[model samples]
Target: MGTPAISGDPKPQITFQTKGITKVYDTGDVQVHALRGVDLALYEGEFAVLLGPSGSGKSTLLNILGGLDQPTDGQVWFRNQELTAASERELTRYRRDNVGFVFQFYNLVPSLTARENVELVTEIARSPMDAREALDIVGLKERVDHFPAQLSGGEQQRVAIARAIAKRPDVLLCDEPTGALDSQTGVIVLEAIERVNAELGTTTAVITHNASIADMAHRVVSFADGAIARVVVNDARKPARDITW
Candidate 1:
């Protein structure tokens, strides 16, 4: 269902809307419910953090929104298009043209330099920024020629972020983007994400277990038992650099 516009109220555009979304995985012996009737709305140019412990369904919801997976029941919308009703080919195109994903691991090809890694995405994108430009956005211009082995953990993650943003995607979905790094290094990675959201106006959603990171988001959505427990809108968002843990 489409989000109804309120009269005399200027609502920010909804980038994603999910209604009664549910996901069930059959693992032979058990049917695991990954999402339980989740209703969510994400606004354009907003930074949202999905805060929850492991197995809380945050990642499952992200996967659905990113077109990586489908809901077993209910519907999902990306702007005007109904993702749940989309064909496999359409979903593929949707992921390629609009969604950018960053995972817990920096899935970089070890042999490729940072610039080359970013280049892989740019070449396939419909309208892409220069590989160096993408690296610069993540503060990795100097390390563009450096291989993954030459860079630190945070630097490699930044490279992954650069590759994700190179396509200028409408949505950026990050699943535990900073989970592997120390606090200092994690902050650096978050800064890159913050900068990307601010400068490019990408609708960004990040999944994290760290409560401290919630302060950086425009909205914090807490999940529990495969359902959303609460959603807190941050009246005064903190800068990523100021956050610890």
Candidate 2:
């Protein structure tokens, strides 16, 4: 099925046509190879999971795809544009206009209410939903007026999620978004993300340390030693709360 973003206009077909994509970092004389010829294709509206250990380079690959980092070799094409060689200014514009990010911590503004914190991004986006609407999407309507300090960790993370989706980002990049919460709370956060991915049909990519989270993805990619060790295709995905070790 087509994504929610495939509305009036045609949604640009999303795919990776990498012949060989590699990332390398030079620390003085030492060299670290983060990615070794990653050739992968993630279609539009796909909910994909990436799992790996700390140094396995899953996050590195995600960063490159999001334009936060560039690969050392090969090309990354997001539709028609080549991201790997994009100028810094272009990368900034691409990030601001097309991508939404969710980190492990909820970096909400302490002084602003949940609505206002979300409003901060809505105000600057080219075209964005109202802050109230975004909050409602995450099932946080009642908590909209609460300040960050007044809410629980799960609530705060939901607010952050609301802010990210308000802009209608084409791609949602989440990095260990539930790592700080207990399993119960984390499931709530994951449910919020799942709802967004399913409802909004954002091309969602989540990087997680928890192996169980893979059960919810359409495709689960496991990284080992900077390479894809195994890819599991799930015919049926359980919700976050229903998944177990």
Candidate 3:
């Protein structure tokens, strides 16, 4: 047998592979070091949670990963493309084609119905999934026709998630996606995000102050003093809606 025939499965795509990433902010002669060289690798379709205390650089890291901010130093690569050195137009296209963002506040257009708000992004995207189908994945298909004002906070957040995924982006960046709601409502929002991640296989990173959310992630990174203090990989991940911690 001449070197038993190897069936090669092409290497799995890497969503983000960052090395020695740093972010610094300057305010009136004061230098704020947000991140001091963070090294991370997020494989395609991984669900990662960034956990930390207030003043930690989780948000800053997430922003840099999502193309909302550039690093002060170091290299940032997404799908083998160097995001850190990419031009503004290239970054914009990268964000539009490859990343989606969700924040603490449900940023739905109040004037638009749930479906319409999601449709807006799809209309501007290169290739998009159907808006109604994306909403359905978040358990909001029944509420698609309802305006933002007509929906509850949980419902609105679900719509916001649908909007984010409608573009069929490879990476989903969530900064405190459930921060603004009560625990009960927040759980619902998290469940919606979980459903999307499971169904769409979108690489996700959630920046959260709630350490409880860490159990739901495949990997949890703890940030302190603008640096990662710990990284834990949970072999058994708790579902968002089922987690009490």
Candidate 4:
């Protein structure tokens, strides 16, 4: 069976392509290979999970795909644009305009209210959703005026999700988004991410070591020793609320 469609568009086009991608970090005395001869593709409006052990290169691949880092060798294409060939300024513009990122940490300004924190991105975005609308989508409408300190871990992560989606990015890249939370709170954060990907049709890639989380992905890419070890296409997907680690 084919992977079940989370978005109505089942046969969406490719959003990103990597050909023989490799990333090596030279530490003067030694070199660390983060990715080696990796080839991958992510489809538009798809939710893909990167699954692996710690230091298996999942986060490194995600970082490269999101334009945070470039491959030392080979090519990366974000749609028709060759990201590997883009200048630093162009990469910055691409990130600002087309990509949204969420990390394990909420990264909210402690001094700002939830709405104000989201407004920081919407104000700079060329065409953005209203901060309130974004918050509402993430189920944070009631917490708009609350500061980060006033919210729970899950709620703060939801606010971060809201801030990320307020710009209506083409791709949402999340790195261990629930790593800091307990199981129950992590489920809530995953629910918010699920809502964003399903409702907004953002091409989302999430890196997590939790193998159980793979059930929610349309496709799961497993990493091992700086290479993609396996790629699984799920015949059916469970909603985040239905998933349990």
Candidate 4 matches the true fold with a TM-score of 0.96
Q: Write the per-residue lDDT of candidate 4 for residues 169-234, one digit (tens) a residue.
A: 999999999899988889989998998888899999999999989999999999999999988988
What order do candidates take by lDDT, descending?
1, 4, 2, 3
RMSD of each: 2.9, 3.6, 5.1, 1.7
Q: 1-245 in candidate 2: lDDT tens per residue? A: 22222223255356544547899999989999999988776667778899988899888988988888888898898867888778999999998888889888999999999999999888889999989999998889999999999999999999999999999998899998988988888898899999998898898899997999999997788989888888887767888779654
lDDT of each: 0.93, 0.85, 0.84, 0.91
Question: What is the TM-score of candidate 1?
Answer: 0.96
Pitting candidate 1 against candidate 4, the one with the higher lDDT is: 1
In model 4, which regions exceed 4 Å deviation? 1-10
Q: What's the lDDT for residue 63 in model 2?
A: 90
lDDT of 3 by residue, 1-245 (tens): 00111112134456787788888899988999999988887766678898987778999888888888999999998887899989999999998998989988888889999989999999999989899998998888788899999999888888888999999998899999888888888898899888777778788899998989988887788888887787887767899878664
* Regions of model 3 farther than 4 Å from truth: 1-13
Query: How do all models score by TM-score?
Result: 0.96, 0.91, 0.93, 0.96
What shift in Å separates residue 230 of candidate 1 from its native position after superposition?
0.4
Residue 37 CA displacement from its true place in model 4, Å? 0.7
Which segments of model 1 are wrong by more than 4 Å? 1-10
lDDT of 3: 0.84
Q: Pick the candidate with the highest lDDT.
A: 1
- Candidates 1 and 3: which is better by TM-score? 1
